[model samples]
Target: MLTIKEIAERANVSRTTVSRVLNNSGYVSGEARERVMKVIEETGYVPSENAKSLRTKKTRVIGAILPKISTETSSRLVKGMDDILAKEGYQILLANSNLKPEKEIEYVRLLKSRHVDGIILSATNINSGLTGEIKRLNMPFVAVGQHIPELASVIFDDYQAARDMASLFIKKGHKRIAFIGVDEKDRAVGHCRKLGYVDAMEEHQLPIEEGWVQKGEFNMESGYHCMKAILEESKTMPTGLLAVTDRLAIGAMQYLKGQGLSVPKDMAVAGMGASELSRFITPSLTTIDFSVEDAGREAARLLLGYINGESYHEKPQVVHHRLLERESI
Candidate 1:
């Protein structure tokens, strides 16, 4: 409806002066700028994003590709990213890859083609091929929640955090401990957490029994089903469990409860990554406090750095986290 020309005509100033006022640039006299902006507001003259983007080459939109976006843990990280970017007057162009590496790559290409200002990818891993594309496109991006050795990733020390939780269990007199993890992909936190369990078990000289470890998808159903299987296989059931994440722990706890086993009374459960329900659940989950918000903030920082032509070659950034001891453990 209302255009910059109309505002310029009404204010008797050049169109460039009206544009400067619209973008909040202070080059024009304050009185002129204020008059132009007031007329702009009254006239309901919203600038066209496409036209502005074409001229300035800034969409003010950040692209993001996430694995299983609806999941509790990953969604928290997404929310954190959205929160930080929104405050800076930027929007997120989101895509979901459903935990598939190939799909993630395809989405990466799409984001680049769309000319997103920056991208935040949470995926299986950044392959050697993907790194080459990153170099060629020179897009601003950072991987989140897991490690990518040669890429700028916003991740937690997942392995150490889980290991610390396992060590805590040992301190509480748990000798027979079980670990339920997800598949081992290079950048997946599930396997990293499982590695932590192994580290703790090896360091404490606890027997790494064949049947004590189980791997499954990180979901409530998988946790319940696999834990039930572990219960069935054990002659002397485990005293504690190191779940790959809070989602898995919640599932495992369900199975434990259905079998007439009480958490921390008959079994102790601890997991990596705290969730909202972790503190309010029946027994109150004992978990590692992996800070998604911190990772998100740092991811934004890395992207802005890349945008500014400051590249940190292959040096990974690690976010800090902690093991939270609660009633469940």
Candidate 2:
């Protein structure tokens, strides 16, 4: 419970000199800084974040709103963001929305109430309500995974990534391809990805059956059901399959195996989000490496720019993606 005045007295330096050494602001002589450091080390004195924030109007804490905290994608994104933010002496305060749109907006307001320096939203869905809430807050904000107009964002080319995977299937002589996706409310993963698959199929003059396209939730259980629906309903069986997520693809593969069908031999499968499980899974999953961690880093950088009063571009920052070909395909 020591104060700066006490430390300054012990160090035999003026309070202003101690302040300079602590904040790294202005300038302090080397000898004065050394003396301040010795006193701080001897007493294990820690600066009060509240006092510093009150003086500087900066908490040095960034609020991160994630769709789901337990997922690998979220973890990787957090790791990337931390890698950048920590070096800048910023800490992350996490808020999980659990894939609920209403919760996303609620968290925005809560983070603002907490006086966070900035917010990074790893969004699964974007709507007017959420965007309006963010705009109303008038704080430093960065959206990830989906583009928000007039707002800084770190996004992936979900459309092109899906197209690339579908094209790979076509190149491998797959004419009849099935698609497993989530609800279109998740525009990036559900809508754009489905569009990419459809466009690719049409471009190659491949016919798509109505039953071949199945919508499912963002979980393995949903994937299994969607695959079952596709198998039961499609008049003509698809030779290849593309899922919007690795979990969905893995679930479909699991269903296929239970039915005594072999992967690549019966139906080639591919998914997005090059998750670690994708690499270790049986037959290995062919997936897209969207560089999620890089997106997190980019989002952190963009948020920092906003926090630091830097001029920012209105256009979304797009992260590159690559297809990881594996035995499943």
Candidate 3:
């Protein structure tokens, strides 16, 4: 229950200096800032956010919407965002959609009603309904993991990552390559990644059979089921297989193990995301490192900039990725 007067007294600074340090607005001397921070920490002094919001018209709170919360990709991105926002005295109010597309749009309206300063959306798809709501909200927003036409986004180079994986498979002397991907509604992961894989095959003058391309959900079981379909339906068996996600690739590997096929010998395999389990799995799965955490950090940066009235002419910020070669490929 320490007041600003008591904090200023403890830190040996004027109340104005303490106010500057608390708001992170006017600059105070580095030493004085450190002293004030130390005193606040020691006393466990909590500021009145309600009074601050009434004065400044800023809640200093950001609403973050995620498609799913259980995955490592989501967790890493959240960590990166938290690292940046916490430094600026901002906190996140998370809204998890739990993989339901309808909930994504719903959460946008819900978060907007909460009067948060801004929103960082880990979007799965860019549809008219979602974009329309975002536009109507007229709030600062940054889309992560998916790109919308006019919205600012922080997204990975999904197409290049997928294409690079295909090229690696080709360089390793695997001609008949197969692809397991998600639905086309997801422009980044599903459509762009699949397009890149297809373009790579065509660049190598390798004809792709209809059966070699299988669609699956973003899960291990779907990858297993789609891979099984590829094996059973293809007139000529593929020597290389690339699944869009590590979970899918791992599932495909499981099917191969059940069939008693030797990996990288009888059939080579690779996946996109550098999931934690990818390296530890049998023989280690070759994959691409999309830097999911960096994307989150970038998203937080862009959204905060917008809220602070900084103009970025560029729409979406693109993140880089790397190809990780492992035993599987």
Residue by residue across 95-139, what tens digits does model 2's lDDT show? 999999999999999999999999999998999999999988899
CA shift of 86, model 2, Å? 0.6
RMSD, each candidate, Å? 1.9, 0.8, 2.7
Worst 10-residue lDDT window for candidate 1 reads 185-194
Candidate with the larger TM-score of 1 and 2 = 2
> Best-fitting candidate, measured by TM-score?
2
- Candidate 1 vs. truth: CA RMSD? 1.9
Residue range 1-329, candidate 3, lDDT tens digits: 88899999999999999999988879799999999999988888889999799979999999999888888988999999998999888999999988777899999999989999999999888889999999999999998988877878888889989999999999988899999999999999999999999999999999999799999998999988988999999999999999999999999999988999988788899998899999899889999999988998888888889999988535678899999999998
Candidate 2 ranges beyond 4 A from true positions: none
After TM-score superposition, what is the CA distance of residue 227 in candidate 2 from its true location, in Å? Answer: 0.8
TM-score of each: 0.93, 0.99, 0.91
lDDT of 1: 0.81
TM-score of candidate 1 to 2 decimals: 0.93
Q: Which candidate comes out best when scored by lDDT?
A: 2
Task: In model 2, state the lDDT of residue 66.
Answer: 96
Write down the worst ten-residue block by lDDT for model 2. 305-314
lDDT of 1 by residue, 1-329 (tens): 77788889998899989888767665899788878878877877889999889877888889888887787766777778877788767898889889787887788789989888988887666677666676577677788865566568877887788788888999999999998888776545656777888889989898877677888786779888879878888777789998887888999999889889999899999876788889999899998888887888888778777766886647678888877888998
